[model samples]
Target: MNILELAEQNFLITFSVVIGIGLLQGAIMGRGIRSRFPSLKRHARSASIVLLALFSINAIASVLKFAEPVKISVSELTIPETIEEIFTLIVNVMGINAGVGAAIAIFVSVTLIIFLKFANIHQIARYFIFVISCAVLIVVLLGKFTDFVPTAFQIMLYAFYQFGITVGIFLVTKRKETDVLSGIK
Candidate 1:
């Protein structure tokens, strides 16, 4: 296995997961909308359907393009030409010891958002994302003297995770479909 291969795999895996996510989102949103205000379901259905289509096409194309080997603005940064090598490069750059754990963590977070129903969920989840962002910021701050990690990269990834999580939640739970909204109708 090499970095290029690993990167390619990541790209494919990412696209596949996003598609799976789209299906999950549709189911959850449908449940939420129908259970809450059945009247709105008819209109909301179309919007959610369109969202799924657009999301699938965009996610797949973006990942495939991103999987291509690329150079970085930072010093001595060249992405591995193979997927396996890409994993090594990622591990080396992030100082991440585990190879598959990052993907697992993302999946776990998504699962948590899906199965758990904490109070003020959207705000709570946003706060959770904020905490994640802060943790990344702290790591970057601590790594200051080291030449390896870039602060900019850390910031970017943090923002990416935050938005990604938010979107994931949106895909999984639609505003019209929530149990909380049921009483209002």
Candidate 2:
């Protein structure tokens, strides 16, 4: 069978795997955040619930958007011959409007900045992440409103979004071990 057919047949499994990975990533990031900012340890359960709810909404919206058939015109079906062309094709398929794309870019930029500020990582690594995230935002904004930026940079922006969301999900989900032991006792 064709790849599309296989994907259609295993949609449920694919969705589950994606969500499972997101959850795992979120949990790890949350623990890291809590370790870095001990003030958040007191609100782990509530934070987890809020994050889970947000994730559920996002997943539902994604499923709803993709479950329907999409129509592609003949001109749009041309195969991309180069890496740059492939990236452009992917960006076009995402179909984000300029205004929405700009808003998302801004939001992602702010989120990444906040995450990097509080992330439990080495200073050098934090600086690298901060610089890369800002660069990705700039590239995404230019790509959205102008033609000078390469669409391949949009992939980096999306990756930042994924990381931000995962970290947000687990931001306060890690309580101190003593708290857990006290509850058990």
Candidate 3:
């Protein structure tokens, strides 16, 4: 109805689109992995790294822009102060910060995995490392969701930015044969 309301509406729709796209991407990627099965299994570590790298890039972006202004612009439309601030915080914090942290977690876990294998460590350490990775991944997702936007659309947009970090790195790093490429032979 009004200018601010309109801006909020647009913001909602934009993010919703992102989430929808994310679901679609996940489905397609999942199918690809499934079809490849055992062959794709070999690529797991690299794939995890890709997710981490993308998330980390986003986190870096978030850290860099944490104190920046609200960035809302569409065609000739502009957002009001209150709405802009909310979205701004969401992007800089939840979208970026959380993502970067997740990436680093992935890297650390992957490294440990490689070292243990190389040194001929037992199953105990490997299991612990796997648990740690799961913990990091869960924490990141929880933290991201906790920084909720006001509406359904906001959630979608934020999800888009959040998942963008995960998906981007995944696509980029996935070319490698191993997830933990650096430590291996």
Candidate 4:
């Protein structure tokens, strides 16, 4: 495949990887939060599920955008126009030049993560994940790096950012668990 095709495939794989990480993180973090705060069970569970769904949707959008496998257009998609536009801008600016639908997927997922962070969900790890991911996404969306770096490097940076989220979850989970067992009283 040509370099552009390779880039598209790399992005699709990246989105899929993020979805997997998001699901695992959500499940572990959600379970931990509910166990720590029984009163917030409903809110915690719902938020985690939505976070997973957002990532999954983005993965699907990326898949549909691949012309070699299939052709999915923004006009024919069911995702909201605002979401489509945001994704279009990100993918175009980042050099993907396809899959407005995929862009919508990642954008919404990141947006939801930010929203959860400010909603006071009681999980420090959640906030860390949002902050890190948002910083990366915002920089890419701004298209500031287009001229400075190759597209492959940008995609690799994103993959590394997602990996960092997993590490944050582990650190936060461990610290929170320790705090519970310390018996400060």
Q: How many clashes in each candidate?
A: 18, 1, 7, 0
Off by over 4 Å in 4: 1-54, 57-100, 103-107, 110-120, 142-146, 151-154, 160-185
- Tens-digit lDDT track of model 3 for 67-163: 2323333342445469867686555543434454545644544543453455432354345445643653554454444442234443334446447
Spell out the clash pairs found in candidate 3.
15-156, 15-157, 45-179, 46-179, 55-99, 56-100, 59-96
Query: What does each candidate score in C-alpha RMSD?
Result: 14.8, 11.6, 16.5, 10.7
Candidate 4: TM-score? 0.35
Superposition-based RMSD of candidate 1 using all C-alpha atoms, in angstroms: 14.8
For TM-score, the strongest prediction is: 2
Tens digits of per-residue lDDT for model 4, 1-185: 87546756687675665556554454344444434554443354354455445544554553333212222334554544697787866554444554566567658655544545444354555654556556645554344332333355455445443444444333333332233322211
Segments in model 3 whose C-alpha atoms lie over 4 Å from true places? 1-4, 10-14, 22-41, 59-159, 165-185
TM-score sort, best first: 2, 4, 1, 3
TM-score, structure 1 vs. true: 0.30
Candidate 1 ranges with C-alpha deviation above 4 Å? 1-40, 75-121, 129-185
Question: Considering only N, C-alpha and C atoms within 3 Å, which residue pairs clash in candidate 4?
Answer: none
Q: How many residue pairs in model 2 have overlapping backbones?
A: 1
User: How do the residues 12-124 of candidate 1 rate in per-residue lDDT, one tens digit apiece?
Assistant: 56445444543433344334434443554445546555544444443333232223212223456675799998887775554334234434443443444453443232444
